[model samples]
Target: MTFVSFLRKNLQKEIFQVKGDKLIHVLPLAKIDKREAANYLCVSVSSTNDVYITLLNVMEEKTVLKCETRHNWLLKDLKLIDGIDQLQDNAEFCLHFDTKIFNLEAYSTASKYAFLRCLRKMSSKYLQYELQWIHFDQDFVGKSHSLLVPDDAVLSMQICLEAFTCACLCSCF
Candidate 1:
């Protein structure tokens, strides 16, 4: 059998597959450091070819790593969003790594939040930031008053608005 077929067949087995939620994120492994013993199976199978896998099982409270290399990081080490760019939100939100990491395209708003919720569960409490969308009853002087941002970010905006209001009131006299 071809390597592709062999991999497909093996991946279907229960040993390789774990039961849990669908992947919240699937970041690629830039460097796959494999043991010399791992090379015994086939000459064609190189460390570079193997796509390392990291499974985030939120319900089970574990992150499983099936990397090309033997060494793997547990949930605690992996889940902390300490890096400044660990999470990015634009048209889409991505967790961990800026480049070459897998894209988690959450089509619906609910799905996006579900994914974020799962991510928050996996992350450290301080590092976790919930995503929220804000909507005002009406636009402010025709300017759009709708926004979607992290919960922590809203605090600063609120403070700035309060300061602006106070300054305006003081100046009015």
Candidate 2:
């Protein structure tokens, strides 16, 4: 399997290892607003409490995984690659960039889908940036390793690039 897939599977397993505290917020549902989507969207984050968010740039060999004692992921810039339903009944989604990959999970399938929808809507509306931030990593420092691309991945990437180019050309008026 590709490194990204392997990391994704392992991370999914690790995320399930934790069953967070059962503390539900008591608030009324408000009208969905694009401006408020970024902050209002919430999900049950997984991984151990000790694991802090880490942003790594593999190609540049640069990282910004540490800043303060804790991080507010809602404030950072991120992109959701694969939406929810990658795994049935297991609220999980994948995020990636040119180098890094982030796996996030919610409590249930409903919450997972809801979070994914809100995130996609918000991102498309406001944060049109590429997926360059890494928000979930256990070993912050060592997580900056270079991405491994095998022969299959290279071929798949070529195929995808060709398809994308064709689509772009066809769409041009």
Candidate 3:
């Protein structure tokens, strides 16, 4: 079977939308984080090559927030965690960018998986990166890490570490 066909059959290709009543937008310490309660939200991703994340106000049916990664490399990180917040009964996930972090909850675990898979597939395609799935120590963090790294990213990661180490050594001198 062709790779595209295999992916089409195995991967999630549907636009995923879920309704929830909470959202937390976090920025760096320099800025304040905002949280909303009892606000209905509809989060969805389009099933297109040019994928965009649309956050809607379900009550008013208005588009509240829309984000698109014009450059795939702009997406810094993506994580999926379960039962992180005892107060939230649904599955929670986070999308980390350079400037902001969006923590959103899916109505159910199934929906969360569907949304994540679709997002990951699009990201991998556009970013031209191989996704590395790393499961964290459940005992410690209870989180799973999904990293998009190009094949040569290992070298890049190593080089970045070396540069950091060198800077630290130079500072000691």
Which candidate comes out best when scored by lDDT?
3
On residues 1-173, what C-alpha lDDT tens digit does candidate 1 reach at each position?
Answer: 85424443443332234432122232211112433112111111112232223432211114432324233233333322221222333223333443333333333322243334334443423334432222211111122233575322343455478789999999999
| All candidates in order of TM-score, best leading | 3, 2, 1
Give the alpha carbon lDDT tens digit for every residue of 38-139 in model 3. Answer: 222222233333334444321112533322222222222433323344333345655555466566565443344444444456456665664332222222
Per-candidate TM equals: 0.25, 0.29, 0.36
**Candidate 2 structure quality by residue, lDDT tens digits, 1-173:** 85434433433343323344211111112323534321112222333322113322112115312111112244133434464343233445565543565555443444433333434433434445333322222121121123574323343455478789999999995
Worst 10 residues of 3 by lDDT: 22-31
- The weakest ten consecutive residues by lDDT in model 1 span 37-46
- What TM-score number comes out for model 1? 0.25
Clashes of 3: 0
Sort by lDDT, best first: 3, 2, 1
- TM-score attained by model 3: 0.36
CA displacement after TM-score superposition, residue 127 of candidate 2 (Å): 4.2
Per-candidate Cα RMSD to the true structure, in Å, reads 16.9, 17.9, 16.3
Q: Give the Cα error of residue 59 in candidate 1, in Å.
A: 23
